[model samples]
Target: MNANVLRYSAFTTDPAGGNPAGVVLDARGMPEADMQRIAAEVGYSETAFLLPREDGTFEVRYFSPLAEVPFCGHATIAATVAHAEANGAGEKVLHTRAGRVRVQVDEQFTATLTSVEPRMAPLDPDDLDRLLAVLRWHRDELDPALAPAVAYAGAWHPIIAVSTRDRLARLDYDFDALSGLMAQRGWTTLNLIWRADADTFHARNPFPPGGVVEDPATGAAAAALGAYLAHNEALPADRVFRVHQGDDLGRPSRIGVTVPEDPREGIRVSGTAVRITDAANQAG
Candidate 1:
């Protein structure tokens, strides 16, 4: 089956910023191998393939350069905006590998994804130690308020909250070592964060699992962080948080997060998308 692939950056209005994703408008009859090949050929961290549904929604699948993921926030954001433009901006239901996700595009072009139910689990001490060593970080650098844990919102990420922004900025890690650990633990990425205030945060994601050193804007990890914050009651109910990410990578990105009172419903992450120049549409 021939599929058309489009590129767009999610969570930022700038064409050069945010997380870039490949979107397939029609993916009917495409095999897994073809999808994987297309994603790798596109060379984006993740690519989205949409299977249009009869009810005006679509079935979406996410593939990284290396493999398929359960769900991808940035890709979903990108796909939603693309769909809205091709179709119309409104509510769309996405059936993903992880679960059902509902995306809504506002009049201002901000796409918000209401995640699936999120959960968190304590990380084993040994795993945390190994991860810290891989990043060449000492245990003392960790924020006491935010304990290290494994959080999940469609994908699993090891959350490490740093006490200072400087510590988060200097993000150098042993890629091979960290990648090995993530592979062993089945982790999707490492969510490194610096809290700017009770309602604002700065984040960086090490996505060795996706064969990428860093993700410019990570919507899945942002959703996971929002779940963590709400579980701990770290922020007020009326607060709407902002996450600044990808600054150190030169592709500055901003993610908006809102934590509702209900813990059962997943977090809401909003961002705009901008279409960049069509890359040589090289689909394998």
Candidate 2:
């Protein structure tokens, strides 16, 4: 209960933008219940707890207000930046429930996390139907170029690509229904996206299972999205793209993704994080 938690916003230099996350630099003996309580108190989309090991690696856990997640991208970035500010900018390996995640922090406070080996699976027809129904979206609105699928890179996300940006902007969904469906399917968030161009995309994530209505910036989903684009062969020539998220919510976050040619390799998600001071926190 007396843990020293630092607040940070990831994917944006401004405190008002991006996704806010709580970072517990040292939670060596904290119980799972305490972590959950702290996460709820923080009231962010997610919080990260780090327990250091003898080998210098850290065993990390991510928690939302409702439950624990296998992995969380924004929290990882925020924690890494906080760690870098305290220690020094360098690389660190995080042992998460999903898998080992390698993270690097630069002098500029930019952090890049390499996701676990990503994979994609076909979405069940019945599940897709239910999902679309809950979101009040029809099949005709979907983008045929990017087939719907469940993509995983440290966490599982259902990728739903819409044809137009306007369709993606109007995000009105049945919260309770979507929550039940996500919980039953063990999905972390629904990655709703629309391709702006060959290298630019817009995303909105619905995280009902986490007790969050929507996530302004979702790093894990961005990694999963990279895998989805690669699997569908929809990547541009460079296999790099920018994800613009949180604009609808007025947060305005930017996430950079780099997809490797090797399907078995991890995707690289890069972004900057800024510490949320007491005044900034109060303002937010």
lDDT tens per residue, model 2, 8-81: 99999999999999999999999999999988888899999999999999999999998999999999999999
The Cα RMSD of model 1 versus the native structure comes to 1.2
Cα lDDT listed for each candidate: 0.90, 0.94
Q: Which RMSD values do the candidates have, in order?
A: 1.2, 2.1
Q: What is candidate 1's local distance difference test score? A: 0.90
Stretches of model 2 off by over 4 angstroms after superposition: 279-284
Off by over 4 Å in 1: none
Q: What shift in Å separates residue 67 of candidate 1 from its native position after superposition? A: 0.4
lDDT of 1 by residue, 77-152 (tens): 9998998888788998999989999999977778999999999999899999998899889889999999989988
